[model samples]
Target: MKRVQAALQHFAQAVAAAMMAAMFLTFMLQIVVRYSARLEWLADRFPILNPSLYGWTLEFCLLLWIWLVFWGNAFVVRDRDHVTFDILFVTVRPAVRRWFIIISGISICTALVVSIEPTWAKFYILRLKKTATLSTIFGDWIRMRDIYSIYIFFLVAVALRYAWAVYRAVRFGVEEPVEAPAGQPTK
Candidate 1:
């Protein structure tokens, strides 16, 4: 069981890293292409190849970035690296803190479940509509665009992670170790 969990964690990390790299590279490529064209004065030389095309590239790149970031968020939560109000927890008694953590985990899991269906529906609609670049006739679904794929992946991952967190909270009662502040007393 431990090995399986470790493997899953590693796989999630790899997926997140790959997505982030792809998003970064896509944006960088778009920037380089746009700047190169501008430097070469090709926009003036070729009326058809205008700077407006860069706007399309920017939109595509932004969408990719959103997908990558959201997809990676699940792994962030799994690792317990997501943002939190630690100071409040620290002030509470350990037993109370444990209950609070468990309750919060369950609430988040419930929320994720409720939200997933609608979110997936939205993605399905977009996919069915074949949304795509204005210049291209191929819709996102037909082209298998990253936006649709990544959104689906993100929703699934978030649901799974939150579900696991809820399971852990129930089974273990949320006695997970809290990291100490740097230079603080361990006890």
Candidate 2:
């Protein structure tokens, strides 16, 4: 399980990194193309220029942004880095803190479990729709569902993490470990 999780963590990080690079390259290419389109001098000088420069760049970037947001949530769960309103949690007694942690984990798990089916149905319906660029290029369409695959993975990943947390809370007291045994790994 640990090895599988490590692999998934590495894969997610790679995907995130690749998306960031692709977005940067796409934006830079767009900027160059836009400037070239504006400047008659550049256009006349470079006969090879496609003033449109893969008009799908914007839509692609937006798609990448969506995946990045969703995947980042999964990564946060893997790393246990999700933001918490810790002031109240910090002020509480340890026993109260355990209850708070367990309750919050249960609430999140409940919400996610409840929403999963409706969300999947909505995404299924969206499979009928095509992106603007695909619609323009091909009368037939690429399914929006295919584009949103990462989001489904992200939801399941975070939900499972929450469920695991709840299980851990039940088995082991929920007060976060503050000290490490000698030579033990942290986090």
Candidate 3:
């Protein structure tokens, strides 16, 4: 199970890296194409390099960015990687910290689960809306819903993650070791 999870984590990180690479390449293409219009020689040599030809690049980059953010947060980024104001949590006793984890995990899980339905409803409604450039490039098949679908995946992944954390907290007081403040002695 540990190996499987590690494999999944690596796969997810790879996917996120691929998305970032794609976005970078697309952005570079957009820049080159945009500037090519100002360079007559380049434009004449490669008429297809017209700035208008790569109009889809911006939209595509934006689409990839949306997926990258939600997908990375859901699968690639770990809980400890997130920023948190945990001064109170860290100051508390181990038992209180465990309770805090349980309560917060439950709250987060509940919020995410509850938002799923409304999120889906919005996505369903967005199915009718097509991206201006992407739809043209993809033969009108790419809808707003398709682009935003990663959000649903993010919600589900986070809810499940929190649920697992809550379960672990119940079974074994907070699994993470609380970091002591500066000058503080080890408990």
Candidate 4:
């Protein structure tokens, strides 16, 4: 179980890194083309006429952003990196802290379950209608909008992982370390 969780964490981190790189490269390329004299002619030929004009670049970048953010969130949950005001808990007994964490985790899981289906259905409708800003064999047929499904996928993954973490906390009564804020002493 630990190995599986560790693998998932690593995979999410790698995917996030790749997505970030892709987004950065796409934006940088656009910037250079717009600003650099050497690329002026090329830019003029392929002016940013509209969101549609960027075609795959825009769609792919948007998808990458969604994936990166979602996956990064999953990573955060799996690693228990989400922010919290645990100062109050610090004074409480460990048993109470464990129960509190479990409650919070269950709440998060409920929210995710409630939201995921509706959100996914909305995306599915958009995809089914072949909705897109740009029309092309590559964009329309391949349907870049379908990529939005990844958002739902990652959200579900994160929710499940978090729920599992909560269960582990409740059953095993383990409290992961909390990092001290900047300039604060380690407890």
Candidate 5:
């Protein structure tokens, strides 16, 4: 099970890395194409020097960025990597902290689960809307629904993560989060 989970984690990280690489390359291509249209030498040589020819790059970058943020948060980022104002949580003892974790987890999980249907409904409506530039490349087949679909995955993944956390807290309880002194950094 541990091995399987580790492999999954590596795969998720790889996916995120690939998304970032693609976004970076697309952005660079946009820049090169934009500037090439301005340079007389290059413009004279390349008939396809119109920056507008690659207008889809902007939309593609935005799409990848949305996916990267949600997907990375859902699978790649660990719980501890999240920023939290945990003054109340950290002040409490281990037993109280366990209850806090359980309660918070349940609340978050419930909220996300409840939102799934409404989110799906919104996405369904979005299917009618095609992107301005991307449609030129991918044809009318690509809609706003396809670009934003990663959000649903993010919602489900986070809800499941919280559900798992709640289960673990119930089974073995939670320990206090490690903290450094007032001035020292956490290791």
Candidate 6:
């Protein structure tokens, strides 16, 4: 299970990276085209007529941004690196801290599970709508639900991560995170 989770995390990270890169490229292309369009001489010389790839840039950047955010959340959860108001928790005894982790993790997992159905329904309804840029250009339009499905994946990954956290906290109690050397893996 750990291996599979790690593999999925890696895959999600790679996809998020690719999406970010593509978003950058498309945004740059929009900038170049917008500037080029300003110069009538250049516009005339170029084979392109409408130098407004703005729609495409906006659509894809937003699409990629949404995906990257949800996928990134899983990474944050995996590392237990989410925001902490540890002013109190940090001062507690080790036994108290373990209980805190377990309790919080269970709550998070429960919340995620409860959200799954409503989230799915909302995204499913989104499927009825087509993307303006991607669908229009591809001719074989993609549904909004397809783009929004990343949230579903995020919810599952996070729920699993938190569930694992709860299990570990229950089985081993509150333990400090192992701090490995810069280049070494934590045991």
List candidate 3 segments past 4 Å from native. Answer: 175-187
Please, what is the whole-model Cα lDDT of each candidate in the order they appear?
A: 0.64, 0.76, 0.88, 0.69, 0.91, 0.80
lDDT of 5 at 94: 87
Off by over 4 Å in 2: 1-3, 41-48, 76-80, 134-141, 176-187
lDDT of 5 by residue, 78-175 (tens): 98778888899888898999999899999999999999999999899899999999987788899999999999999999999999999999999886
Minimal lDDT window, size 10, model 3 = 178-187
Q: Which model is ahead, 1 or 5, in terms of TM-score?
A: 5
Quality of model 4 by C-alpha lDDT: 0.69
Candidate with better lDDT, 5 vs 6? 5
Ranking by TM-score: 5, 3, 6, 2, 4, 1
RMSD of 6: 3.5
Model 5 residue 42 distance off true place after TM-score fit, in angstroms: 2.5
lDDT of 6 by residue, 50-122 (tens): 5653566678788889988987886633464555566787678889989898889999999999999999987
In candidate 4, stretches whose alpha carbon ends up further than 4 angstroms from where it belongs are: 1-4, 36-56, 76-80, 129-137, 142-145, 176-187
Q: After superposition, how far is residue 178 of candidate 3 from its true place, in Å?
A: 5.3
- Candidate 5: give the clashing pairs: none
Error of 4 at 178 (Å): 6.5
- Give candidate 4's TM-score: 0.73
What tens-digit string does per-residue lDDT give for candidate 2 at 1-187?
9999799888888888998898889789788888778787777888645675468778888888888889877773444354545678767787787788689888987887777788898898888787877454434657788778777787777778888887886788756545558876446
Candidate 6 — number of clashing residue pairs? Answer: 0
Name the candidate that leads on lDDT.
5
Instruction: Quantify how close model 4 is to the true structure by its C-alpha RMSD in Å.
Output: 4.3
Kindly give the number of clashing pairs for every candidate: 0, 0, 0, 0, 0, 0
